[model samples]
Target: MTTEPQRLQYLEAMGLTAWTARYRMPNARPTEACEWELPVPDDGARQAPGERLHALLDAPAEPSVPAPAAPAAEPRERPPAGERKARALLGGLVPEAASEEAAPGAAPEPARSVESDEPREALRFALQVACLDGRWLVVQPGQAAPSPLAQRLLANLLRAAGVTPEHPPAFEAFHWPQIEGLDVQAPLDEARQGLGAFLAGRARRGWAPERLLVFGDEATLARVLAIDDGRSTALDLPAWQGPALETLAGSAEAKRDLWPRLLDWRREWHGEAKGEAKGDA
Candidate 1:
């Protein structure tokens, strides 16, 4: 259990403000401390952003996990709908790249209805990477194109990393099967299995990145790293063979807070790469 002060501190660090329920007993003085309790979902594995953050704050901190031996590729079928919910939550938080289509006066596609049975939940998340050699990989979220804001942010990050915008980089991306809606939660067992399978497939294809720059709430990190502990700027996971850094997801305010830190990290990474080259020489 988390104390009020500690809970408030965690919320503050995550850039969130907590408030009491709209309805309250008459003549009763509302206490902010008492309202700190977050509503938990029925499924223990699938948690709302607030509950996930609390879990992270409450868990004992552990050292980064060591990188494990490379696993051989194996045939595995993708998990079913409910199984993908936990990962979907993280996917929904991260925006992917948008392809620039020059179709002359093509009508805009309609947004998918949340109530529709179509598995659009899987389409809402994406992973993108921009390399220095003018190459980029944009794992597109569902059927939707990346938002303009997401595109700009990715371009900016790549430019800051020394990639020229004009030349751009090789770009590749894929969409996952649509699940239910983003709001649905999956059971813990199913969520873990889905995440494991997804990561395993990516690893087998040599798609593991040295570091993942995650942009979203604390829950996004929890889902990606499969850990429920205190939040940190950096997390090392042997499963991905790298460390991941957390940042504000897609918001103007996040841009202000994240860019400086991202640039600094890029500089350090470049310096380390150069040092390794010099040592080898």
Candidate 2:
């Protein structure tokens, strides 16, 4: 059998805002890297101001400031309640994307949940860092439109990437608006840059994906590894002819030893009425 990595625990970050990245090792506990920085935005509503300062900066003194309009899409939704818990050392594998939407306020639905019969007996825990392209997709089940991040990191990523709306549900962020089409949520456009940096930092901390895909933009690839010194670099992943949008990582076989056990006290959080809920999914 192959030996696991000696060290784990990594974070993907950039300037002001960043997310955490966790790594698992065979026969050992999983760990993660510290957080990083990405810039903050001035205002959530001020995102995607289509005029450059150069034009307005040189324009007549009496410029017309247009009124802000409601977002050009459906309203936001409420997030489902409850997060999963886990314990245990792992066998050095990752998990697949379990994309089932939980009803609003329902019992916890797992992206992946681990429970075992022993203490600290779970094999691993999971982190759901959702993103809508460069934007951080903040969506729930019962909501309307999403709120934009009032942060610079997100804005720069959008501005730097030349973000645009492809379809109502599709917004793109990139350097060349014509070429780099990143479909993201409108509210998240502001924080795109920072999120990219966050994903990059996560990669350094052993959160790298064995299989990577790029949908919307290269940030999908960044989900696996950070954007390095090279732009025209090779994507690190297995050979799959499927769609490029879903960059997958890890294997179920490597996660054999995850200890799956709920806390003695928290088990009752669901209560016995969850018998039917437990049987589903």
Candidate 3:
């Protein structure tokens, strides 16, 4: 639980101002008033723009000079909406580019939506892969490190699955666009290829798992499933897709709903009459 002073500090850090009641309420504990601690500058310090503006406003005003009037200019027609938008996009840096199609009697260009104009972002994915007791767990990446409470929940889940300390899960991270800032034309294909290669490499090293525990939504799980081709020819693991780890961590009802599915998978893959332990290589 956060104390009042700590809460005030947090608010100040976020650039928020806090207001306090002038009078104390009946049956309430007496509390110190929250106040802004604005720094006071020395007399020799430079004046702020506001102070200078106030000084200038208080000073005598100078007489302004009248300029000669010029002849009125002819009114021009407004350009089409597309041309106006193009000009705004270019910031008037290239004047000729904006007016290239401004020829007399030319048809207006069709308006394009901003969404259509912008390039679509590449599909990106991050997954937490863990190998435990002859099973591969591919979970949606959560916080870099889980909180103590979240860790406890994960431990409980593992224990329920008959995992032991002697067979701690081996973890790895998989991310698309592996090299930061690298432009990937087809991220979906690349991600599938990369993931497939990783799985195949692990299999060749004789670390193949019997079952795959996938934790993601349908859309996310689909991408992982689509890698069944040349790249992962060595793998033939049975899979069980379920809700993401973060979802299970936040919802007790979701955890309860997951047990039946987990038990079914354990029976099918591990052939465990009960959720019994299996030796993992």
The global C-alpha lDDT for each of the candidates, from Candidate 1 onward, is 0.42, 0.30, 0.54
The residue-by-residue lDDT of candidate 3 on 87-188, one tens digit each, is 543465333344554778888888877534332354566666666654544444542544456556666776676444346555566555444454444455
TM-score of 1: 0.32
Cα lDDT of candidate 2 equals 0.30
**Candidate 2 total steric clashes:** 57
- Which has the better lDDT: candidate 2, or candidate 3? 3
Clash pairs detected, candidate 3: none
Please name the candidate that would achieve the greatest lDDT relative to the true structure. 3
lDDT of 1 by residue, 38-82 (tens): 566677566778677556545554655555885545424332233
RMSD (Å) per prediction: 30.8, 31.9, 17.9
Q: Give me the runs in candidate 1 sitting further than 4 Å from their true place.
A: 1-145, 163-186, 218-221, 224-253, 271-281
TM per candidate: 0.32, 0.15, 0.43
Clashes of 3: 0
Better of 2 and 3 by TM-score: 3
- Reference-based TM-score, model 2: 0.15
